[model samples]
Target: MWASILIASFGTYVEKLVGYLLPHHMLERESIRRMTGLLPVSMLAALVAVQTFAVDQTLAIDARLFGLGVAVVALLLRAPFLVVIIVAATSTAFVRWLGWLP
Candidate 1:
């Protein structure tokens, strides 16, 4: 067990070290940087869209769609971040509880 743990720890450390010590210029060209910057928003949008529209692994509009709309409006209005999260979550939960989801 100890030997296994040591090997795993060493492997993990080496992988992390390689990641940290790799040349940034090699990994982060202009196009790569632009793509990286866009990635988070795109990923978030995909997640939100999927969650809003997915039911039992099939596509169907649901309460999460309204929640996302409210979230967007809250973001546009510069509402407090916590308030927006709370409002979105509560609104979505309420909508779900209303049995409007199908």
Candidate 2:
């Protein structure tokens, strides 16, 4: 586990270092700029997918997925960020309390 963690951390550091060392002109390309702008959203989406669906390397849906759904609805309604988080957590807890999920 420690070896894997170290390798992943080192790889990420190398990737960032390479980015930093790349030519400014290359980094300034429109396509590169567009991808950089979208990187955060892509990372967040991946995070959400991993958290919502994966457990012990297996896909398993539970309160988290439901909470995400509630959060999505709240977002669609233009709810505040705090409200979105509160609603998602509350819904998750409520579902768990009701034994609706394992």
Best model number under lDDT: 2
Q: Tens-digit lDDT track for model 1 on 1-102?
A: 999999999998996796589987865689977997898999998987787788777887777788888899999999999989998988888888987753
Across 14-39, the per-residue lDDT of candidate 2 in tens digits comes to 97898789778977899988998999
Q: Clash pairs of candidate 2?
A: none
Candidate number achieving the greatest TM-score relative to the actual structure: 2
